[model samples]
Target: MPALRNIRMLTRYTAWANERLFSALGELPAGEPLAARATGSGNMVRTLNHAYVVDRIWQAHLQGQPHGFTSRNTEDTPTLDALRIDQARIDAWYIEYADALTAEGHDEVVVFQFVDGGAGAMTRGDMLLHVVNHKTFHRGYVADMIYQVPARPPSMDLPVFLRDTVPRLT
Candidate 1:
């Protein structure tokens, strides 16, 4: 039960951090020098787009819908405003999905093929954890890109989220 609660908490943090960062990204001036790297390697916008694609793929998998992202190199970039809107919608869906999950649901084994055409299976919980970790890893990449910009980068660290947003936890 504690582990389940912990997963839920992690899910919440993921959604919250995503919303905060995406909102900041939306506020960034379009066509500005800082925004030029939106599509560049290790860029915030690219990393965020990658996360969005992965999230959509996983959501499809979870919902038994046709999976997208057949190849890892698939490049797609929307306008900042469009990306933010899509991110919010997907984040909300993930939040709902996480909240509705039960221990039994976590234990459910899912068999699915990878984007690379490899078949595999994993517990729903493991896949969910992967989703969270994957996003966190790319978020760090985005933060690094932000550091390259002249302006100050937002504090996106999980501890920062915990301290500032969920202070009562300690």
Candidate 2:
């Protein structure tokens, strides 16, 4: 039960952090994120898009349904506004999914094929943790790109989220 609570908190933090990142991205001049960068994913928007795509893939895996993603990212990237909307939906879904899971459910092992046609299996909780960790990793990429724009990136640190945002949750 405590572990489920932690996962729920982490899921909530993921959603909160994503909302902050999107807001910060909104302040940048149009096309800034689309400009090629020298880091992962080649551009800011693409990096975030990659995170979103992975979120969707893991969401489908969690649901035991087809994810329809052959690669980690789509060939065409959505505009920031569209991507933010979709990302929020998935993030909220993760929060809800976490809230709905029981200790037993969290321990359930899911067997699914990797995008590279390999076998994989993970407990539901571990899969959820991976989703959070993956996004956090890509957000770091975005933060670096934000520095290239000479802009300050919003902080999404878990401690900050806990201190400021988690207490507001019921």
Best by lDDT: 2
RMSD of each: 2.7, 1.9
Can you give the TM-score per candidate against the true fold? 0.85, 0.96
Worst 10 residues of 2 by lDDT: 161-170
Flag regions of model 1 displaced more than 4 Å: 32-42, 167-170
lDDT against the true structure, per candidate, is 0.73, 0.92
lDDT of 1 by residue, 1-170 (tens): 76577667777788888877776665556643235564444356666787888888888777767776775434665666777788778878877887888999888898887888888788877777888888888777666556566445567677887787774943
Q: Give the best candidate by TM-score.
A: 2
Per-residue lDDT, model 1, residue 133, is 88
For 86-152, candidate 2 gives per-residue lDDT tens digits of 9999998999999999999999999998888898999999999999999999998999899999899
lDDT of 1 at 2: 66
Please list all clashing residue pairs in model 2, or write none if there are none: none
